[model samples]
Target: GYSYSNTVPGPIGSILGPAKDPKANATLPFACSLCGSCTDVCPVKIDLHHQLLTWRKEIRVKGFLPVSKRISMKMMSWLMQAPRMYRFVGKMARSIVPYLPRFMLYNRMNDWGKQRELPIIPKQSFREWMKQNHDDK
Candidate 1:
């Protein structure tokens, strides 16, 4: 089910597909996985992933994306682009996740955790573990 979106050209070509309605195309960008596999399999070699990314940017600019998705994307972008913030958030998540109640983390706000248990943060980061282990060498 997860890979279906990427394997087929429906979501990728929603904007340019045979559909005559704009409403049908507007939501198409969200369904694509943007995995580029479609482009590879296409007879004409269209850049499916690139177009999907462009459509996503256009959708964001048009303010069509849901607020929750937009906010989460913003947070993720910031977390990845800023190493300090990433480290801080990693430490905070690790320290707080264990202490927090299941209801708080597994609630409606967290769709990712709805289906399964959340990941357990390790006691030490890779950097810390390497530092300790390599100190003797």
Candidate 2:
């Protein structure tokens, strides 16, 4: 039921508005869900999602992203590339997150947790499960 017009206005305003402040418009691109719904509905077949991704890259390159977000992104990138470290962190999270106080997990710093409840942590990782269930077969 959502319309492309809803998402189009922000980017259009940022591009056409007299003030060319990247910092001011930095949040505009990220406002999108990147679901490609806008692109699907565009009459001109514009790649709105891709354009939004480009804007995000430009904003990050221009250092408009907040310091906390930048550090978190870097940390995630590092963790993702190191498989052993990633597994260790995952195990640690599974073991520690549920026991952590609400304030610790749902604070202002946890933007993802602000409006949503964390999912119940599983007893074992998917890798462990797969090994147990499939490797013997």
Candidate 3:
């Protein structure tokens, strides 16, 4: 066997675990969950859940994934959970973007403002949207 440089497989399990096994691929499901969260969280808004499900259908039902990509699915599940943490990260990011050289920022994130406008920070979020709406009654 050729020497594979991937780190996903441990020294115990060789370079690649079997692709279809659930235990080996945490991201396969987490990607869908992230999709759901994104659908709810998108400010300008997009239906990420449907797209994720479609991706799943295309990948699993259609058997389109290559051997290398299947095992790397564990990355998504470990990423997002707390609202405060997410907001903190957003604030940190927003604080940083203005300082970056404009060309560097533009080059790093293509279409950085092609559609999205600079966010107008609201007094509260959509959760607060309902509360404020009800309070006006």
Models 1 onward score TM values of 0.63, 0.72, 0.32
Candidate with top lDDT is 2
- Report the lDDT of model 2 for residue 52: 76
Query: What number of backbone clashes does candidate 3 have, counting pairs of residues 3 or more apart or in separate chains?
Result: 1
Flag clash pairs in model 3: 27-73
lDDT of 2 by residue, 10-107 (tens): 54543322135667566666666789887888888888778778877888988898888778879999999999999999999999998999999999
lDDT of the structure predicted as candidate 3:
0.47
Error of 1 at 76 (Å): 2.5
For residue 127, what is the lDDT in candidate 3?
55
lDDT of 1 at 5: 28
Which is the winner by TM-score between candidate 1 and candidate 3? 1
Task: Give all candidates' CA lDDT scores.
Answer: 0.70, 0.75, 0.47
Residue pairs with backbone overlap in model 2: none
Which stretches of model 1 miss by more than 4 angstroms?
1-46, 130-137
In TM-score terms, candidate 3 sits at: 0.32
* Full candidate order by TM-score, most accurate first: 2, 1, 3
lDDT for position 134 in model 1: 88
Candidate 2 ranges with C-alpha deviation above 4 Å: 1-21, 31-44
